[model samples]
Target: MHQVASQLPAEAVASQTRPLLVLENLGKRFGSLQALQDVSLDFRVGEVQCLLGENGAGKSTLCNLIFGVYRPDDGLMRFAGREWVPAGPAEALDSGIAMVHQHFSLVPRMTVVENLMLGQSRGLLQHRAFAAKIRSIAESFGFSLDPEAVVGELSVGERQRAEIVKCLMREPRLLVLDEPTAVLPPDEIGSLLDICRRVADSGRAVILVTHKLAEIAKVADRVAVLRGGRVVAKAEMATADMGALVRAMVGREVKSLDVALSESGAASAPPVSAGDAPRPRALVCDGITVKDRHDAVRLDNFTLEIRAGEIVGLAGVEGNGQSELGMVLAGLQRPAAGRFFIGETELTEAGPAAVTAAGGGIVPEDRHAVACVTAMSVAENMYLNKLDRFTRFGLLRRNALNQAARGLMQEFDVRAAGADVAFSGLSGGNQQKAVLARELTLDPLVALVAAQPTRGLDINAVEAVYRQIRAAARRGVGVLLISSELDELIAVADRIVVLYRGRLVGERPAEPGERAAIGALMSGHGL
Candidate 1:
């Protein structure tokens, strides 16, 4: 990886005649929270500028300001040497600025071409012309997008390509991407970086917003460290090493994974042994096939056995049947065909309650969307799945629930203001920890699914999660981990299964440095 300082000539040394965009004394406040405080930065055409910060450090707020989601409370934005204040998304796009949010924006039922042309303002309807434009753009960007393919049918990588295509169709001079690689496998991350570079080399500017320092080191030309809503360090990517960037972003020197692993005795340690032989099959699926609301098969011939004392990883690019499999296993959806068993009890048509009663615990993929109710208090949300444990005869038992929530919160190390606080008030990492706490505390015979369990978490929190997973396995709990992050999967899983196009295509032992090969298999490049 290039050091940050060597990457830039010097701040005193100017490379270009003019910057493409400049934010002067940018500031935004939400109630008492100073989300962005006097943040100033510049992006030049044909260069990739990476923004790094922890969650809630005001990175999203800054992007929201630039995208016109909320007008800056203070500061001036100049683009292409013109002062600009975009009214909204349309105005922002009109001003040669486009942003792809962390969350997907494409309509699930719409085709790629339809989505690309959703908000276009052509005076006359030109479906054919727009489709042709999409095809041309996709080809130029080395993207194989089926313009007629439904958005819901595309893999996460393909959906991301569609988003990029949507922005490219606008021909924006500056493209902003927020956490673009968060849902991508390690090997696919390189491809995304290549696409970003290609986009920038095409004479446009790219602003990458991410918290992963390794990714910044790989792709950023210029690195800007954001801390508490302020740019603490700005330097060339080639000159700034990960150490320097870590110091700038977190205001402290951070240890690398190797160092951390050694210090924690994670490396050079004997493999933790399972307590005993687990029940023959805690959860079993035989020839299972699942379909979506539209009756499209999202999972085909998926057969798996989860035994106690094992962590089974479902590795794939997002949208490659992982989400649907998780839903089906969790009993949120019933498979169209197949037999599902929890300890020999048939559950093919069972609902979530029945699944839970059958000793299944689910940590859903989308924490906000499906796992927890944002409006509910943390205590309430924590006990949502195990309400019967805290209540009797359909009457509420507030004391028991609160006690359970408090104990679990302490055990899980979930950082929250208070137990009564709304779940939405906590950070993303804390929310995930809360979800884990609830599901794992139930001590189910089988853990249905957990996706991106350590995403957006700090180093310490990640360590905690890893320890939790190990402990669960030691207790003879069957864990089904579904994630795009290959490193995490390899670290926690005993075996890895690759899914491609809604089918189980490959299997391998989880090993370090084998990510590229596994990713290739997941993309259907290997037999």
Candidate 2:
């Protein structure tokens, strides 16, 4: 058990409305990397404070320090006008601080209520009473989660909601939410922002860690931007504005996505003509069916096609068979019925190796679990899909692998200490870049299934990924882009298709002002 001081220092009890939390010259280091340095910030009650940063800009480090997941190597943190030294998350929670991490920490095999009950009550817990309370919190937060639903059976978005509700059940004075909107639909995003504001209005504080600039103006009273292990900028939402935040985040003026896309004028493959040959279909699926653990039909006879040199967007609310569809396409999960093809060749009941062996690439949604081996070296993970090229007699050629990995890193701008650095050592953005570099460069790679490709990425990183996907399309690869962000689908995909309950319901052109219609189709309104 960890301990915290119960009383505030007499010298610091001067003001009644003091900051709820305060950090002064705090620092943390992970080996050679100074993850955070000389950071000073304040969190006041009755305000939604936003922490803005690039993927590797030490935002997570700061949060961990606050929640007692990690101790500061230097400086101090004062909570409620006291020198707070919470030795662990339990102590932090005891002091009225709760956290919703980016990655879910629920027990998958347990029911939602069961998962939340763990470490909550010291003695015997009345399941019914706890479930009723959970339901109340869920309703207040605009979330609908079945208390008895098993965590593993729920979709990614549903799991996220469960994780959030778990923290909210504590009713803490300070709440930390890390990229909570990454898996939520646009319609739900407004509701979530409202929740943040409501929490603040109740004389509590919310520290929202996010990269989306639009969100700052809506819910945030104050904003802080971090870069290179330091706070580069801080301002009230009304003062500095979005552009200033972006400039501070990336250290330069970045062109907005719309401006960049318009200037590029990226076009799809030319329409087939009477005298011209039909565009080649790079990937095709038909009559695909899938069932969940509870024998529930997730996808029913779902089918789609992607022609060479085209990017097709799959749009829907989260948990609507989007992740499952991507898994099926990547040959990760076997479909209950039907088959798919890559470039005219039938791919019946496949695995990752077989798909990649026959012209397929995949960017999985859960990068840590599916797309990467974090413990391995970055260079080794880069060649994960194509080991034969760097191996002879079942052994890797170290020199050649390093040389090639160096080239790919430079080409993709994968920042790291060295090619030998552990994949986990890199930031989230760099990890995604490394994965893309590996998958996109596969020879004869005609099709790609990118699931939630830019989720949780900063604006600059998102722009970079969009350009890379477009570049792959230009190289005659067909791409099925699965995304929850409607704007992303519209900007990146040439044709947008809707998915509802594992079925394709409708489609629309990737044109401006088409989100509402597509959103409706995704919600199954026209079914």
Candidate 3:
């Protein structure tokens, strides 16, 4: 446990009304692991309370206890000026508490309206009015949704919108959101924060659990830092800075994204001299065009070139051809026309195996589906694309493979039960790290394509991924980083390009001041 400074700021002092929910000396354990201990906090009405910490820091564990998903071994909790104990989520919901999980709990086969009316006592026709009300609320928060739309057909952001609507339908007095921005785009994060602010202003309590430090400054009225399953620090948002929050969470000084830019002197791309020759090409996409299963044009004559020792970032909103482009680069999807090359070797119409054999690496957006086999052991997953190296006389060298897996796990700092453990048992961040370790460690790597590489990662894990990408670029590897985070693109990419409706809308040097322009381009506005 760390020493928490017990000084209240002006805002915290003035807003010290009766707390909506209070927890005192809360403690919980799972077998030998103490998930939470001595966690005490007060969540006040009409304010946003943020639980800030790295992954597995007891943030979600505390939320589960409040939502009745788990029973705290030792604690005292009071709600509405009375002792409160709930048996399950239904009891908690009926008591004016609702939790929106990181992974939504809506039934995919049902319509949005049907999903919202699942446990309501009201009739089905009454849900029509509820649907109208939800639409109005979503509009106010700049969310566009269709109540009649099937949940399975909704995009990631739209599904989150439906999840919020479901929570609001219950009129929850205390609303808890876990990692709300994990699947949202960079631009949509502001809108989500605004929604939280609006909910708090409506005289309701909001508890936001996230590891992104930037989010704390954006919406948190009060911030609680959890570390090693304990409340290590607590301070009013007005009094806490990023540096303070980082120290409390990780117990060390870590360079934030902005600070890294300042130290690198690469805030903006440098100008090329007239005499400078064109850089040697590492990856080239020549007039490529693609379509989806529905015959919707996904890539419209997309063309781009990346040079060795350079990083080119692809930025766009979801469903704006980024996914299709990444698939084409990884040789998973056959482009309708045009072709791509790896360092002068043409790889048009090639499959994923040939592309990997040609020294190309792919870190997909969805690691589970494309990168690793969840049912396989960690060692087997590491050699998924390169199993030939460990095979002899039609048999796999199990001992040699396990030895290599151990070495790679140690090098990647992968925290798992063991190399023999199934990949599915690992956390999301660890799974992504495994993919990176496998892809980046390839010999004679020519080009690397990473899509949303840091999605759902904690601060420490994000830093590690960034360092690995930077190291790859330093080794003269051409890198294509496709992400929704503009801040991430500007931090490391040499150039940033925007895709809109399957077309290249704009291209610019990665610069700090160009974010607004890039955002406009991403939304299919001005070039």
Candidate 4:
């Protein structure tokens, strides 16, 4: 990819690491779109090589080519110093290459064990024999998962772990992880990076595709950045900092959170002072309790309230019940004991439609799977949650549906060719924007529950999303932002609450120099 002329710099040439995989002038084309161009690189054994790029910058295309998801138009690949060619994913896996895509590939309706054994040539007896090996590999990577757990019943983070475990079961010499930490909390992210180091230290190569610039310094030994389907810069991590990586990917300098989101800016909140009249409560929860598929308590007597125009942030070490709480608010999970209300209207057992009718909205963590229908057009998905409005008796209103979609796309800055484009065709940022436009445009919306809304987004996309959330709060819509980024919580929220073992352990007002205290509370400190 920058800072070099025709070959690698002198410093990189000085390294003695052996290349496990080598690509020479790799190129791939999809119709008129040249998704990848002359992407020549080497992945070395016993090292973590990070691939940094903006969404749609050909990172996925290159990874797909490497893992046999797509055949390269022209190139030469040498794995272990031999010509490498694979017909399909199974061939790649059999040849010691495994990939965990950003979007999961597990069958949600089946248990983890069943999904893992779906395409195997072995019978049930042989498959059951590998269950112990799978569990052992999972535990070795610090992943705790039940082989018999239904994929649909697992949380987003749990599902991610299952997908990773599936790949590790193959014991590949080269492991590719695409945006693995996008849905993980901060602590879990650290652990995942550590596991990557372990993978490399054990004589394997890890190709990490991620949007986070900070992580490269933590785990990567070499870095390559992609821009507009071409490699712009490639260097040892010791020579590249976060700022350099950002400049390489975007070709511009980006501002930090402190400099960009000032106390008096649009992302700011007014001080909590004595008011003239009491503001109306938009969202309230009383003694909510939830359990997992195995009947383990997830949320225990979680009581909270958010007044109109206020933003409350939910912070926790992941799996302490943040996902469960968000589900209860979204009407997807019925709490064991609780009464959730929107403006004094209790909706304890209401479905998603009823909750929407009661002035509530949610941006789920897994947007591709749970939030939007991937096969439908953008116009259809924008109104899929409220199709009744676009239908008259048994007749469909196509014109009206397309018109509404066009309006929302323009108003919310959704980058797409047209309303008829497939929802899955848009980039990750545009997809999230469309989901936001659909959920936040309810006529009488008073509350919004957004879970990890900025995860996996580039810097510009993150800024756009932060502005939208703050704008919603300014419009008197009570907002509950559940995220694992402490700096993000402090930046966008007015108050931050900690959840530990499915209960509120403590809370602190969003203030200067409070990260350490909040982190302590997350670890179950100070009672």
For each candidate, the alpha-carbon lDDT, in order, equals 0.76, 0.84, 0.81, 0.82
Q: Rank the candidates by lDDT, best first.
A: 2, 4, 3, 1
lDDT of 1 at 145: 76
Give residue 361's lDDT in candidate 2 (0 to 100).
90
lDDT of 3 by residue, 1-527 (tens): 00111143445334537798999999987656677899999998778999988765777779989999888999888987888788999999989999987656788889998888777775445867867987887887676778988876555567777887778777788999988787777767888898787677666789998877788788899999998889988988888777888898988888877575457543322334689876678799999999765576878999999887788999998767777787888888889999999888889888898888777899987676578898999989987887888999999998898889989988877766577778865656677888999999988788999998888778777877777787777777888999988888988788899999889988987888998898899887885
lDDT of 2 at 128: 100
Taking the candidates one at a time, how many backbone clashes does each contain?
10, 0, 0, 5
lDDT of 4 by residue, 471-519 (tens): 7777888888998888888888899999999999998987668888998
Which one wins by lDDT: 1 or 2?
Answer: 2
For residue 146, give model 2's deviation from the true position in Å.
1.9
Residue range 1-527, candidate 2, lDDT tens digits: 00111133333232325699999999988777788999999998777899999888998889989999999999999998799889999999999999988777888889999999998667789999999988988788676889999987777788888888888888888999988888777777888888888777666779999888788889898999999889999998877768878898998888867567556665445445699776789999988888987788898898888889889999988888877777888878888888899998777687888898888999987787689899999999998876678888999897898889999998877877778889987767788888988988999889988888888888877877788888888888899998888888887888899998788999899877887799889888866
Score candidate 3 by TM-score against the native.
0.81
Runs in model 3 with CA error above 4 Å?
A: 1-16, 30-32, 73-91, 104-122, 125-134, 147-155, 258-280, 292-295, 330-338, 341-355, 368-406, 416-428
Q: Assess the local accuracy of residue 256 in candidate 4 as a C-alpha lDDT between 0 and 100.
A: 67
Among these predictions, the greatest TM-score belongs to 2
Every model's TM-score: 0.81, 0.92, 0.81, 0.89
Worst 10 residues of 4 by lDDT: 1-10
- Report each candidate's C-alpha RMSD, comma-separated, in the order given: 5.3, 4.5, 5.9, 4.9
